[model samples]
Target: MTGFVELARAAQAARQARPQVPLALATLVQVDGSSYRQPGARMLVDAEGRVLAGAISGGCLEGDVAARAAEVCASGRAARLMYDLRADLETIWGFGAKCDGIAHLLLEPLTDWRWMAQAEAVRGRRLGGAVVTLLDSHGGGATCALLDGDPSPAKWHVLHDDARLLSLPELLPLAHSTMRTGHALLHTVADEMTVFIEPLVPAIALHCVGASRGAEAIARIAHTMGWQVTILDHRPALLDELDLPEGVMRRRVRQLEAVHSALAELPHDARSAVVLLSHIFDVDSAWMTATLPLPLGYVGVLGSRKRAGQLVEHAEGVLAARGTPLTARLRHKLYAPIGLDLGGESPASIALAAIAEIEAVMHARPAGFLRERQSPIHSRTPSPRVLERDQAPTLPEVPLRCELPEHPAE
Candidate 1:
């Protein structure tokens, strides 16, 4: 199953285990002007008021949501929250927010586990699917359906819709929009039309090799960034000593063989990033050489540039002899001497750089000083033209006169 579906299933299972528990489902209903999260983004909140599935906003909005979730859990009622980052100076300052847009969050109580179960069933089918919910319409409720068969140009059926029945052709376009939050499809058949859409779950995963302090820091930051983190280390003692979040998975594996086995088990997708900080040169080298050929989102090596060059050379020689072609694309994907140019020697700083670089690569952005780029720092507004044609002065031509004062001066 996909990560999003698994998260939904997990949250559903958690709620099922404790029927009395109240769950709040926070979804991004609208994105006006500009915002961190787009429409249809969702985060599941547990009865304890803890975020179980996704992130609504950054840290700025989570705390308030947690508090409000507690209240909803206690009251067993749904609530709608609208956070406008551009409200007042005091309001923005109080929330520690600076976004110039508005985000609408629907914190609904998950009192019905049956709907969740049905959603899980649809997800388990492994087919392209969508969940359509009518927030304020003639048919007001959430319904999920699976798109049977491979996604093609043709449309498919949406499993559950009691208010209005839709054919395959009518629902396919809606499925695509359902990948984002609050996106809907208005289908016109005969004289009537129905709107169907839902939010998409974000795809992100974190892989940490070695239980070094740097790895711990990366895991912590990645967790906050809404990544499913898995920590693999040779030393069991190191794993035991580390303080990691509950979401992070720790695996005890020794030697390069174990590393290869672990990587082979992961789902190869663009949403996954792997970081190697094994300290041991031979182990790190071996893992890199073996895994370089595999399709992965990002692969980072923790070491000096000199050491990384040596390792790359060794891998190239070995792979060449084995008749495996190691191309430039593969080499570039291998981030040796990982992280941005933070210029800090400490583990924490190194960790920061590593995570930053990973994020940069994942987002297809360059890891450098923002001021150096011609692109806008945050928003994508077109740069204003300083010298427009109408604004430029059309000076009249003037003949130059040469003065013969040299003889007189002499």
Candidate 2:
């Protein structure tokens, strides 16, 4: 979800900078085996075959995908490109991609920028939604639509060139299920049409309740991970002195009494995370007490076990006096001693551990080695049913050396 947001922002910036440059979008709709990126990953390609942002593969597949995208931009037609890298990749395809996988991508020209506009509308809205694309079985046509709002027929809106796919009643349930589960899915109706539903969720919001050295480190690390980061401190001087990444937000929180109001201005959804690392006991305590009742996903306090216990005990007393006891639900959300058990005393190492822990908690995963796991590394959604070979027609073959005409100026 966060990756899609970054791609959306990049595509938007590129369009704004050069509106006359024709562009195409390639979406990885399916992958069957070991791969660098999973389904729903995207890359934007211009007429000159430059990758603006995002990536569908590590580095081996972008060149070919960009070449195909140029043809899409010239013809204004959607095409499906399949790469079978399961065996003897160097001998068969000469690409030397050691990854034993099969990848399917959908490339379409950006004839109208309505899809981009809809994506920008919900980029940071804190609302979960889905993008549904209907594709031809023969790879001749494609239409894209956006689904946002409650699970009601009247509220679900579809935008695209084709109105026939938009009126399909069966797509609503599939799109709703994908959004609810936060998973991407590919579904085929008989052998005529295939639907790809990609979930869109807001990026993780990290509240660094400090402007200390540790806070700066955490902000930089989280920003690299595509998380929304904000550094809050009681002293404006400390905040000014702190160096942060380009997109990191900073707030001067003046008084401990105004902690609630300060937090009110930030995100309060279940995707939100907070770390009380101010090092000032009174300020951390105040923020901790205020955040207990909110809908935050993770809350961490940076200190030793003894200090963490003391801080929580004080918060428990304060909440108890207000006739609201600290329940197990609230206690489970607090991570004292704030990080995974990665052994390091430096601020940078500590920041890495803390970010790792928060990511695990937010995704409901156990922080353990992948080699020890029994299941696949990536989560599995419902698999696409196999279409009959006779019924599934192949896409038109475009020569590798086909010359694409330059995009004419508007």
Candidate 3:
């Protein structure tokens, strides 16, 4: 969703800016065993077979996808492309590459309105579910149904004719599960009917308090990764002189004494995060004093362990006076000395390490060296390879349409 968001916007702009041109879309719905990209990654192609946005593989499969997209564009029909990147000495696709995966991709002519709606929904932070679903029409039973709005188990805004998919008792549970756990699944409703579920929960929000060198780095990296970014400072003079990046929202607040006041300004909920980088213990405590009581994805202070403890003690005093003792869960979630140990004294390096920690905490993943993990570098599932052969199981017949992940393409 992150990769597709920017690309979709670019493609839409290009198409509207130059209506004479035609464009196409490609999305990797499933990847088996050691794929360069994961499921839900997307790309955009033009009539001339140009790469507009996103890349499925590092460089192994874009050319093929682009070529196929061109053919699909000419024919005005969607296509399912297969790329077996298994390292075989016989095939050029595996040439000198540590490839051993099969990629299932959907190629279709670009739809501008749909792409814009999708990107905007993702960027707008109005949605909740992270899993992205691609309803495949490859199984012959094709339908026009596609859900693109803020999806909840209770309701789904189907974009096309009545898919009636929500009526399935079995599917509702699966949908609920996917919402809880951001997992990708390809389910076969019938012979030739499949649905790829790849929940792309919108990027998490990161609020950087008190702009500084480290704050700048955090904002930049967080923005590039498609995280909703807000840089807040009570002091206008200091924040005014700071050269923040273009996308990072710079906000001026009178004070951080009341969380509601700040939240009212932003109107963010638990999915949002707040990091204290003021380097001033009193300021950080004020932010944490208000932030700790609420449910946020992450709350951290950019300082040493001792500083964190000091702020914690101070925040506790403030909270205790207000008749609310900070709970154990909140304490556990707070990182006093925020960020992983990347061992760099520079502001950028520290910022990188810190944001990494924040993100890990947000996703509830352990922060550790990737090499240290026994599983694959990108472990959505331990056995994605097995998915290729024993694909979706047979189910009752139902009309389907391969709903690829949308881009703004906001």
Clashes of each: 4, 0, 19
Candidate 2 per-residue C-alpha lDDT over 73-188 given as tens digits, one digit per residue, 9 for 90 to 100: 88888899888766545754575756778888888886654455455456477776677677776785454666555343444454555424444345556655676677788887
Of 1 and 3, the candidate ranking higher by TM-score: 3
Q: Report, for every candidate in turn, its global Cα lDDT versus the true structure.
A: 0.62, 0.78, 0.68
The C-alpha TM-scores of every prediction are: 0.63, 0.85, 0.83
In candidate 2, position 93 carries an lDDT of: 55
lDDT string for model 1 (1-410, tens) is 33355456766677567666677777666555666665556677776867676677765676567667777767755566777767732464454445677776667666543444444444434343455543433312333343333333332333333324443343443454444222333234333533335423334577887898889988888887767788888889999999998778898877667766887676445557778788887777777777788777788988878988888898898788888877998887888888889888888888888888888987778777877977555432221222232231332232111111111110
**Best model number under lDDT:** 2
**Residue-pair clashes, model 2:** 0
- Model 1, CA-based lDDT: 0.62
Point out where model 2 deviates above 4 Å: 1-21, 91-96, 140-143, 151-158, 383-410
Which runs of model 1 end up more than 4 angstroms from their true locations? 1-26, 43-143, 146-164, 173-203, 367-410
**RMSD in order of candidates:** 19.6, 7.9, 5.5
Q: What C-alpha root-mean-square deviation, in Å, does candidate 3 show against the real structure? A: 5.5
| Candidate 3 lDDT tens digits, 17-103 | 767667877778878787878877778788787887788888878877787766777776677777777654236453556678888
Q: Candidate 3: which stretches are off by over 4 Å?
A: 17-20, 88-94, 129-171, 267-270, 381-410
